[model samples]
Target: MNTTEIFLLAMLLIFTAPYLVWRFCKTDYFAPLVIVQIIGGIVLGPGVLGAAFPDYYQFVFTAPVVQSLNGIAWWGVMLFVMLAGMELDLKKVWQYRRESATTAGFALGVPLLFGCAAAMLLLGYQGWMGVKGKNWQFLLGIGMACAVTALPVLVLLMEKLDILRQPMGQRLLRYASLDDVAIWGVLAIILLDWERMGRQAGFLLAFAVLTPLFRRLMARLGEDDRWYVSLIWLALCGFGADWAGLHFMVGAFLAGVVMDAHWFEQRKLDMLFKHVLLVLMPVFFLSTGLRTKWDAGSYPVFFVAGLLLLASVGGKLAGAHLAGKMLKWKQGEASIIGWLLQTKGLIEIIFANILLDKQIITSDMFTALLLMAAASTMLTVPVVQPRLHRESHAGLMQQASS
Candidate 1:
């Protein structure tokens, strides 16, 4: 078939396979549709499908077809990241500053340290660090990736758990918001290119100077106008950041960060988020899968993924328990909180993709991170749902007794 036809075929597979697996298998309890799509991407990727059926993989995913898919994937992720930035509820975090800061800090910091140690151990070996990477950059990037929380995915899971509008869910959002900021800041640090330092510095300076002006303009515009102008703004910021060597997604995020949620109707924004996932993000996941490599060997990649999972889950839980103690949270609160916060999801995959793009981590490392991300996300709902049910039951029982 021709390139266009092949691209369409690839698209059909991308959308159909994951939904079928998710719906028919009824994996929603443990793994959501998003998780299943991610797994589907990996399965459909070069490492799995391509490795098994080289001729068919080559026929379907030719150079031109792959490039087209990447174009779609890039825009999809940029919009998704920007939406994530807009979703940050800083107002709520500020309202509960002490608890929010403490929990977010431990939640991010402990995993960082754990992940850094894991990176250190990998440093003594080979096939993990990228060719262009410095030891420090690799360590920090990997550590941050491990520490990172997928705020978008966390929001989805909370909604699924029926706590999205509840006090506890709001609290989790506050924590994730703060961590989101920290994660991106660390990414900028990791992406720092001294040779183009001037460009990056100028980008930040310009962003700082223009952010308020952008906000004022946005506030004055009608919603429809805001929607049109935000897309234009997203394009410009993405371009500027890419030109400055910081990557376009950073700019995409900054574009949305300054824009308040109140600026757009919440229902519309939520719907847009869902639609983006339904339509565009599966392409991103498939492209992400194509980038995966087992050059470091399959067994080793799986082993490292397991290690990262241990660090990620263990550190998140430990951090949550510590925060629970400090905040005097009720019994069992930490477990639920930790489990909720531990999910890495799409943001983690995006983070690893950026690292791979910049060559801070090898493709093997990227694969490991990807596997760890998928597992962490899949683990979230199953672990948290039962605990939340018990808590709800107990709350009802207590009210009856009272």
Candidate 2:
């Protein structure tokens, strides 16, 4: 009907989905809750329900409402990324430095190389098949999409499964965290290259240099009831990055990492992020879901989607498994690690949406990538949990025998 009513309905659904999942399922199915909410949004939006009730769907998925929701969702993602960065224990990273470095390098490098190649081939095919955009741009977009991993989701899984404390798990987390930093750096460079060229690149260099100086100043701020100053500083980081044409999440993440070196107020900031994530992260996914326009009966699109899903899963598995073997890990452990690292959830969707908005990739490509991400995420828990559990048990028995 009206904008207010539409907003209220979306809000209501967002609040209710988690409750429904918690009541019915007890296995920490929060990701699936998000997936369901997105599907529900699509059904209730202009795709299905809109086909039957055109006026209502038109009003519901209006430009203003979508934009407002997108802004809220982005704020949610910023907090989420901050929390993800805070989850990193720098000491643990150092302790497992060699293994972590090897793993992270292999995990990131292999996927990026493969993704770039796959994008070239796949985008070429898409061009042949008469999809939009120049081949080079579409290929760049595809490469960018495939190269991303959902760092937040991976961290959450490690935390939820109590794996963060294990030796292998610690190594995985360290590498994944570092991999995220590298990916973001690459993304920043790419965005700057595409958007503002030389000026943006120069500003980013200055920001990098100034970030540490700012951190030192923040540290020197008196601890005599001056924590609110830190919040102001964090806000300034967000604002500055936004002004510099960088995503606010980048600023928020850097802020978390810099402050991570100092223990001051880390816990408080983390708790604040947790609260924000629980409420708002789903909204991000719901917005992504609302944008999903899957053609259930289109064989070409469906076939391409399935192929991409296979590539996403297989590519990660091959990369991680080979890396693990090189690091002299047991075969089973290496396989499981590969599978776990394959997860792609909200963060991947966020990146895909960004690329789509930039018109670097078409709607069909975005949908395919989204599907690939969701499928990969769903496969992680099932493939990883049993192996991790078995490893824990074996380690315990080995300790007892000793």
Candidate 3:
């Protein structure tokens, strides 16, 4: 088949397989379509489908087809990350400064420590760290990956649980948003190449100067014009970041961070986010899968995946529990909040992809992190549902008595 036909076939698999599993299998209660799509990518990756049917895998995912898919994935993730940055409400965090800081700090800090310890163990071995990665870079990268919470996915899960408009939901969003900013900041630090220090410094300096001007221009534009302008801005920032030895994704986030979400209509922004997820992000997931490997060592991929999951989930819960103690949150709130905050959905995968691209973490590490992310995400709904239900029921009874 021609490359175009082959690419279409690859896309066909990407869209159809995940949809069937998510729709017919009714996995949405436990695993959302995004999580399912991620799992589908792993299933279709070289490690799984390729291992089982190398001939078919090679035939379908030819180099040209893979390259074609990659183009879509790159732009898709850039848009998605930008939207996530726009959704950040630093203003809200400021309003609840004390509570937000306490929660966000412990939530990010504890898991980061735990993940660092885990990375320490991995560092003792060969094949886990990337070619260009220093020990500190690998350690910090893995640690930050554990500390990540997918703010976008958290919003979806909260909406699914019908807590999206609630005070608790708002509180969770604040914590996740704060952590999201920190995650990217830490990534920029990790990606800092002393060799390219001059370029990186110039990019930051230019970004600082251009940000206000860009915001001013965006402010003056109509909503229709803003959308077009934002895309052009996204492209330029992405190019600039990549040229500066930082990843384009970092540029994408910076582009979004400076803009006000209030500038765009909420419904339109939400639709754009949804469309990006539905249409484009799946390709990113598949591309992520294409990069998965299991050649780390004698240890199996699932075993490594499990260890990372323990570190990530355990650290998150530990952090939340600490916050609950500090903030005097009621009983049962910690468990629910901790589980929800531990969700490492799209953002975790994105972070892992960056680590792989920067050669900070090996492909096996990426695969392990991917599994950790999917498992962590899937666990969120199941674990939180009962606690949420009990809380709701209790609230109703209390209200009735009052």
lDDT of each: 0.93, 0.66, 0.93
lDDT of 3 by residue, 1-402 (tens): 898888889999999999999999999999999999999999999988988899999999998889889999999999999999998999999999999999999999999999999999989888789999999999999999999999999999999999999999999999999999999999999999999999999999999999989999998999999999999999999999999999999999999998899999999999999999999999999999999987424366678788889999999999999999999998889888889999999999999999999999988889989999999999999999999999989989989999
List, residue by residue over 1-402, the lDDT tens digit for candidate 1.
788889999999999999999999999999999999999999998888988898999899999999999999999999999999999978888999999999999999999999999999999999999999999999999999999999999999998999989999999999999999999999999999999999999999998898888888999999999999899889989999999999999999999898888988989998999999999999999999998877425699999999999999999999999999999999999999998898999999999999999999998999999999999999998888889999999999999999
Regions of candidate 1 where Cα sits further than 4 Å from its true position: 295-297
| Model 2: per-residue Cα lDDT over 259-316, one tens digit each | 6535456576656666776678767866776666645564555566666666667767
**Candidate 2 — which residues are off by over 4 angstroms?**
25-53, 88-96, 125-137, 222-248, 261-267, 396-402
- CA error at residue 218 for candidate 1, angstroms: 1.2
lDDT of 2 at 142: 59
* lDDT score of residue 15 within candidate 2: 67
TM-score of each: 0.98, 0.84, 0.98
User: Over the full model, what C-alpha lDDT does candidate 1 score relative to the true structure?
Assistant: 0.93
Kindly report which residue pairs in candidate 1 clash with one another: none
For candidate 1, report its TM-score. Answer: 0.98
Error of 1 at 306 (Å): 0.2
Candidate 3's C-alpha runs over 4 A off are 295-299
